[model samples]
Target: MAAGRSLPCDDEFLCAICLDVLCQPASTPCGHNYCKACITGYWDSRGLAHCPICKEVFAGRPQLQVNTKFRDMLEHFKSMRAAAAADEIPVGPGEVPCDICVGPKLKAQKTCLACLASYCEGHLEPHLRVAGLRKHKLSEPVSNLEDRVCGRHDKMLELFCEPDQVCICFMCLKDDHVAHQAVPLEQAHREKTAELRAATSGLKMMEKVKSSSVKDIKGSMQRSKVESDSDVSSINAFFSALAASLKCRQAELIQAIQEKQEAAEAEAAGRVAVLEQEVAGLRRRRSKMEQLLQTKDHLRLLRRWPSLQMPAHSEDLFAPEPERLSDNGPQFYAGIVRDAVARMEKAVNNEMELLFHEVRLSGSCEALKHATAAEDPIEDLIFRSMPKPEEHLRMIQRQHAVDVRMSKCDFSPGFVVSEDGTRLSFLEDVRFCLPEVPNGESQPPVVLATEGYSSGRFYYEVQVRGLDNFWVGVVNPAVSKKGRWILASYMNSWGCFDASHLKKLSLKRKPEKVGVFVDCDTREVCFYDVDAKTLIYSIAGCRFNGESLVDFFTRLMTSDDSNHRPKLYPVFSIFGSHSSSELVITPVSPGP
Candidate 1:
């Protein structure tokens, strides 16, 4: 007996002799199924008839025939297994997935032009079987099906309106394009293919021009480098004969000229890099077009024609020339030599003290002006407000990083608060005893941060790892454990909502770390998905004025003043059904 494959196998589908899936299965009178050849060979070897499973001997040999019904069923099962295996591949990177698949979309094998949907082999079986779908054109998997559709009509662009010079749908023929001349998509594809040759030829020419431009830029850089190196060598020789002060000036001049040469060469190198990239891109596109042209299949050529990405190129295809290296080294050296001679003469006379001081301060004054501009309050504000994409959360953390500590109020037992007031967790099978609200005696599993915000902006992050359902937001600081507080609803989706107003922002994924940002000036309380660096929700025009002053305070610490500013303290807790209720006050930190 042979072993079955990795997939789960049923005894009914397996042949007793072969042990693998039944192939041309034949049933015996003793009610046992086996491969036709296996059963025939078994009886022939012993010259006797017997059931392989039950060992029941037969008097005479029976004629063998293929079980047509069972064979069909076996084939059907094999097909199903094959389909399942084909659909094992989900939508991975760079894979066009079947839009029809519900979950973990399967890799697409074909794209239907008429349906405008990609389909895996399993899902594509229906189109192969269905008579109506058989007529619809299908091509190799294409990602951009939307591009094949007519934007105006919202239908597959099957025709080209000659007058308007645009792709149009069948519906357009009886509507906007009723009076205009139109042709079949394939006809237009053939016409365009002829024109495509010219277009691709132009691309080749562009590629050549850009390549030449790159070569020219690199050549210029090489020449400039050689000239600059020679100049530097001459300066080194010249400066070796001068005095210490004169030598210092000579060194400065050499460094300046070398820096200038490097800048110019780097600019040329950068231009060459861009031109080379464009040239390579053009070659790839031209190669794809050439391959398409070689294919004799008109339908494939037509289908792929739309997918060919042809970037717009200006009539002047040449790359811009890099900035030329100016011959400033000789001029600068000459000026330095004249200044050195004049300086010695002036010091001997000692008559231009004020003028010397003015000359000394000229460069320093420009640098000081730049520093003053950078420190301008208005400029700083604008710069801070407009942070780069994905840097929004980090910028907020940097600017408004606040210290958060879990306040240990007199809320009985069952809940564990860390010594430093940074962590909060619940005991096994033990519920927390939190604040008793005004309306009801229901205690929420909530804890407040020690630090409170009354003015300006504040941001803090809470590590909610090991917990599923939780809420992290600003709450009114309570005066005591039994003081007044609003009971916010258990939110599965993260968002901002309050007593007077409500706004919800649905979260796409569960985040391990959650950041809370509060801006008093703008009156915005925003929640951030820290790892994703995305703003989960924000409530604008929010007035966070809590009545309870003692809701959060340093435990046994000295504070004689009872009067405190109306501030909202950061709060977090495990709401809804959760496996773990632990929460950690994460210190604000920058991302790698």
Candidate 2:
């Protein structure tokens, strides 16, 4: 092999007939080796037998035999080439190299703990071939096989101490592990395997939970984006409607002022036209007189004067007095605009105060709307007025169809109830009166709902029209209506709008209809802009202190009152000096 190192591999290993490495080398009598298949095919093609290398002729087909020694040498050469190529390969990252391999070590496949050595596939072949070597423990490749042996005892760690939870050698059993619980390494491994299987199952379950949580979060984000778009649309619609209203009012005012100016101008123009006709007649008479004077004809001048008699001079015709424009006219109209604007501004101020105070009232209403519209027997009309989608998820036990009527006792003179007792309108120049209170406190004008509730949930709607500022919601039944009192002022009373005390709802645009919902069990009350279909505010987690049992019993015993639980009555308030609009209690249809 050393003498043949300089020879070309193609010349030494390749068969001359096939021009490739010999598959099954065969020798001819001429001493040339060729592939058995290649030489047979060549001889058959020509129908003659001859040595390809020497070209020696044979009388008949010469017998060729396999060159066993040459074939063995070729196989040895192929194996040596492979081994040399493997030696040139370098170790890569995260790969355990064979400890026994010299120079560039090959990647290890397994480690023998008993032998305290790791080996590549090539080096580990003997362990597989020899029965005694196979008995040595083998595992997945590891970098430090020496760590498996005990450092103190210099022996294989064959026992597991349960008490100390450390691996120990057989000698450690008599020393440090004598009083500790110990188990065979194999037994401990089996126990640990069972524990790991259980842990893997738990990890799989946790992965599923995390996946579900991620899905829920994605769903929430998508829903939030949709809701945000809806809110923007609703707000834009509200402002557009408001602008239209203001423009309509502006046009009306301008038309009114123009009508008055046109009427005045018409009268003044009529008087001026009459005066001009009289002036023309006078001028014609004067011209005739001048012509007569120039002609020296006294008779013609006298005749023209008699025929075109000059009208008598009158102070009314000559003075031409016209209606004068009042200096305060612009100021008066401007005052009207200012007053209207002031009312609107006040309404906005009150709404802003409510919005800021009830910052926490906002929540998802889409779920509640669906529950009512799809599942509950409540009418979808109740939800139609909602400006935004409901996101507040809660179990609706039942829907209450509450019938509210205006109470005369709590009504003001300005507020006129409808003949059917379902509507309330404000009339101008009417002074609202409060019934005499048992206590010294004054009462503000407020209309109360005839019906009351002490427990459970109730919902209702109020249609607000022709008024910019109006309040609607529930209040305690015991709230005073004496001289003057603020809404939601008393600790027990609650209402949607309470500029004097607490605010329940903040509105961006004046809603035509408002919805009120109260959940006594949850101690929550919510108000909605019905037309916009959005939540204005919510009063949540309301708590009330009870007086003594005797006092509570005394109130409960009253003939008209069966339940002493604080009954909530629907209440309303309106601002502005005069308004024709009414705060009507609209009918609510049950959802199917």
Candidate 3:
């Protein structure tokens, strides 16, 4: 029955025994007391024989007490605390001790309800005891007293009317409401009090809903804390596994680098040692040859008499006969020495070749090692599996157009002509005309003739006034078939032209101020739908009058009125041959 250090005794109150609050109260048993449920529950499952409170041996069940006296004492203490709190009035609760009287003041007496005015009790005697005050009923001061103003005049309540249902000053009831219907303030107050009760009931309902929502929010916050802790643990576990994997990979990479470095160093050292040994052998051979040359016989042979004659001096007679010398004498010795030196030279050359071969092999090994160490394995694998350079190049060549031909024109016109022979030209001052036809394929046919102007591009200029006759089309020979004519022209006056065959130009009304014309006649006057590639309008069997090319253009481009005077012939033609006849087409602006 002894209490565990970590576990609170079952006999003890779950509520703090020292504070004696009843929250989750429990009990303990002894001559001394504690919470009843606390002691019973603490020893319920234990098989010990001692009491939890006193640790005394008990052969039988010890009786647990509820300690009602202690609980009664706690309740009394709480009541006393509440009563004490209620005895003192707060300074802000519409009531306070009177400053002048030095005594507690009743909030109800501070202001006279009948007079509808505020005054301290010390100053309120006149309002209560005045000549007609005995019939007045006073009320406790209200914090919202300022809100009870005159409804009609929006002024502070200064008097209460006995007849009208309103609070008002004497002057208001006497003059402003002389002939109006009114009621006494007491009657109005009763009605307003009922309205106030209804409003307060509605407010209570709203407050209850708001309090319930707040409790739900608190519960949700606790759940969110639990979920957050679980998420943190999961994240930690995942990153720990990732860290372990990364550590393993790092160790492997480091080991591989170390092994490669050691192998390369050992190989380099082996090559250096081989070269050193070969050099040392060469030096030894050279030293031995030098020593052989310094022998006495060899020196004597080199210093042999300049001439074959007997010495004149007797001292020179001691010199031995050169013919009686031993077979292995200076000459034979010289031959053997020369043979040995030759053999040593041959051995040195062989050793040098061996050393050079090792050096070359070592250099190749180092280059291979660097390549292996530097290249990423994945990249190397991908590169090795890729298509050959020649094959890749061939594939690209097959898929793309290497050589293609585009349209070229020798000369082109820049105007549009109507079937009525009215030609409109747009002379571009700073702009170049592009064939409006799709891909310039269905452009009007015009005689493109070159002249002294050798520049491949054509330029012209024209001026337009408000909503008058304007030029709007394009012409290029590259888009026109030979002997076929195309024109895009509009006029203010609508008219139909009679021809053997006709086609209309379906050009977009782009509000463009320029047009180009190309001449390549095949006897058919065909008008193209520039953007659509279909024939929009055409005129066939129109005779090509043999007129001067320049005169024809000049007449067509000139304005009909003299006042406008068509400032300049707004058209020019690049004629390939001066002798050919060509038709021109013109475009007009569309209506809004």
lDDT on C-alpha atoms for all candidate structures: 0.69, 0.67, 0.42
Question: lDDT tens digits, residues 34-77, model 1?
Answer: 89999999898988888878999878888888888999999988
Model 1 ranges off by over 4 Å:
1-388, 410-413, 432-443, 478-495, 546-565, 575-580
Q: Give the backbone clash total of model 2.
A: 31
C-alpha lDDT of candidate 3 relative to the true structure: 0.42
Candidate 2 residues 427-453, lDDT tens each? 766634332221334444778777777
Give the Cα-based TM-score of candidate 3 against the true structure.
0.30
TM-score order of candidates, top first: 2, 1, 3
Q: Which of the numbered candidates is closest to the native, going by highest lDDT?
A: 1
Error in Å for residue 36 of model 3: 74
- lDDT (tens digit, per residue) of candidate 3 on 1-592: 0011123232342243333545323344335454555455555767653555468767777665456666776566556555644643434453533332335543334644555654554345655568777566555555555566656665556555545645674457677667655555566677678989999997787677556545655665566668668977997897799689868975885586567667767876777797688669667756765665667785564554333223366353355633421233346545765797697666556445545444433422232333344344553453243333233222222222111111123223443333343333332432223334322343322322222121111222111212222222222222223222223233322111221223333344422233221121222233333322233344443323323346545655885423211110112221212122232333322211
Residue 536 lDDT in candidate 1: 71
Measured with C-alpha atoms, the lDDT of residue 148 in candidate 3 is 67
Model 1 error, position 94 (Å): 49
Cα deviation of 42, candidate 2, in Å: 44
What residue runs in model 2 are displaced by over 4 Å at the alpha carbon?
1-80, 83-93, 125-136, 144-161, 164-178, 203-239, 257-323, 327-339, 349-481, 484-592
lDDT of 2: 0.67
Better of 1 and 3 by TM-score: 1
Worst lDDT run of 10 residues, candidate 1, spans 480-489
Better by TM-score, candidate 2 or 1: 2
